[model samples]
Target: MSTSTSADPRERILILGAAGRDFHDFNVLYRDEPRCEVVAFTATQIPDIDGRTYPPALAGPLYPHGIPIVDESGLESLIARERVDTVVLAYSDLAHTQVMHLASRVVAAGADFVVPGAHRTTLRSRRPVIAVTAVRTGVGKSQTTRHVATLVQSMGLRVVAVRHPMPYGDLAAQACQRFETPEDLVRHDCTIEEREEYEPHIDAGVVVYAGVDYGAILREAEAEADVVLWDGGNNDLPFYVPDLHIVLADPLRPGDEAAYHPGEANVRMADLVIIAKCDSATAEDIAAVEASVQALNPGAEVLRCDSPVTLDDPAAVTGRRVVVVEDGPTLTHGSMSFGAGVVGARDAGASAIVDPTPFAVGALADTYERYPNARGILPAMGYGQGQTRDLEATIRAMVDAGVVDAVVSGTPIDLTRVLTVDVPLVRARYSLREQAPGRLQAALRRALGR
Candidate 1:
């Protein structure tokens, strides 16, 4: 909880991460600070990212050799071995109680635990920033960000979306990446998760910037923009301070606005609160979320946004048993039973929804074991090449068994882009449609002063 600076010479530090915020904090706070030394980073939440180095190119001049990234399971041993002075938690979407449990472990290990100050870690942007965040993952933050970018562009302002870090691949090579076209995604070797976030923005003709170093990423985005839009990841705060902070809440999962970590912080700091999926949730659930938001941050302007799921071709899955593949993080960490794929499948008149549990292979099998809520629907868990193969194999096993006739993909990116599926892959596309249209435009005008 403390962000105080200590002048202790060579204060050895270890960062607890899931490969995203941990890298950003180091880049902004410790990369250039001469008094502190980042001994190592511990990884969790994300798979296969540990056992790698942060790479010297992005570690700055302070570290001639890059820092080691280890498994968080070895926290105590590493802390004692390195004589660590501080341990920083840099990931998001954790329960407040779980955060404290990690803190307790660090304290018991004779190391100080710190959560970096949002202000200290956030970089200042030369251009005005409008951030779109959520209280949890899969609360329609992606569609909301697209809507914000499109609105800003309608005003003849060049807006570049700066996404939160998901640097699961090569750390040094992804130091500062700019994606202007679809080719950029392939050029950078983006994973399905990264593509799911980036491709939609690119399709909208909005340039997206994401990498390990947010300060450098901000500088690059600001050079060609009049406004910067922060597309936050996993309910984390923006890397750049925003002039207008828009936080989203999911009516489908009411009370999540107050339940998760940093999500509560986002609601407390919001300039506007948008309750997403109003059409899908019951009126009672919607009212509950609205009431919670009012109690938490009464000053924030409240609005409703309807997220409608539509399939590219309904006939493909009509009257057939099909396997549904939903967004990875949404089902696993977001703790959702189903997603747009399920809705779209039922809407398309699918006879039955095939549970991909028995057919799951490799990492896909491990995912089902870890998150039982994801039993019926397959989560698109492609963090690396091996996982991607597992996803493809899982789907193939389902199709080969002659149990399912089609595949319903609810992920933002096209499944055909990454995987080769033999059966007809029906795409489920969802977007934000404001209930009170001109109200959001009016708010945007006020925020930009245009």
Candidate 2:
């Protein structure tokens, strides 16, 4: 979309977001532009992210009185009351039809519906960048990112990982977050989902940066790196331009590569498309995904890989009925019924997977109703302390009533850190492994000009 010009009167703006993209757009494109005044930010898609101000410290000198972050439902009224002249849709993972519906609503409210393109929003880095994005959430983006980082390290280059924004707390403090140690997570008050992504990268001795302002985050990361790896979130595009744009496709959901919102864009833009979890998919499914990618982007290179699943404690899961606790976004908005945990439990000889619905309490129960596709697996939905406590209580109640013998968690971080479980809790872990022998190495060599 065309940015507001100097000739245009100073436009009052309302940003539509889910916390991540909203802040990035403002910081990179609108913060100091002088041609636009962002009246408010509207949040959705993640819980407990609304009702806070986008603190003035990060809002820059232009907005001395910070920007209000209101709930998305009040978009129309806010537009009318605040006299918002523009509404920028700055979030991702939305279908095209859904995007248009919002656009229609914005137009009806007499405001220009703006979606800043990649050029206006994506940052350019000093170091060579490699971005790992996916066709959708839960399609092995994390493992693929780790694989790229590991590859970069193997080449003896310092690589800093800059994750897509998940700034759900104090905007000022989170303007540029750095996570180098487990304690840093506590220092930043990272949510469970944030910990999942950050802790693993920290374990690898890689500094991970995120927060409201990506330009600031990038500068911090670039100072100590030979390469910057953009570990993307959801199915969102990268916040920086890359030397190598590696996108992932899931064979389990074959046609999604060409069908989903920005996923189709990723497939078309990718330098390489790695069809992940091929070993787990049927031959037909694998072929179907490859065919779709080939048709969508005829020149893109395709690699085969698998997110091989394993359990941290397989013995505890053997010969028992278990409850599967999956990644929150995966089972919820990601729309995956089972995650690595379920696969691990099944492989470890679990007799059955207990459906947690009957025993779920509070927000835990609400999750089941919300995602009917939850498929008996419990989603680990702890955006805040209340939700975290509810997760613990649900698991405790289930174990007490003997709903299952063990709990298999497919969540990335160790759940025991937050929940006290009476019975054995098995953790599921998965990592990216190339199916094609030297494809990844060759690609990396080309990317780094080795």
Best of the candidates, lDDT: 1
Model 2 score (lDDT): 0.87
lDDT of each: 0.91, 0.87
Q: What are the C-alpha RMSDs, in order, of all predicted structures?
A: 2.9, 2.9
Model 1, TM vs. native: 0.97
Residue 339 error for model 2, in Å? 0.9
> How many pairs of residues collide in each model?
0, 0
Per-model TM-score on C-alpha atoms: 0.97, 0.96
Q: Which runs in model 2 stand beyond 4 Å of their true positions?
A: 1-8
Worst 10 residues of 1 by lDDT: 1-10
Off by over 4 Å in 1: 1-8
What's the CA error at residue 427 for candidate 2, in Å?
A: 1.0
Clashes of 2: 0
Could you say which candidate leads in TM-score? 1
Error at 369, model 1, angstroms: 1.4
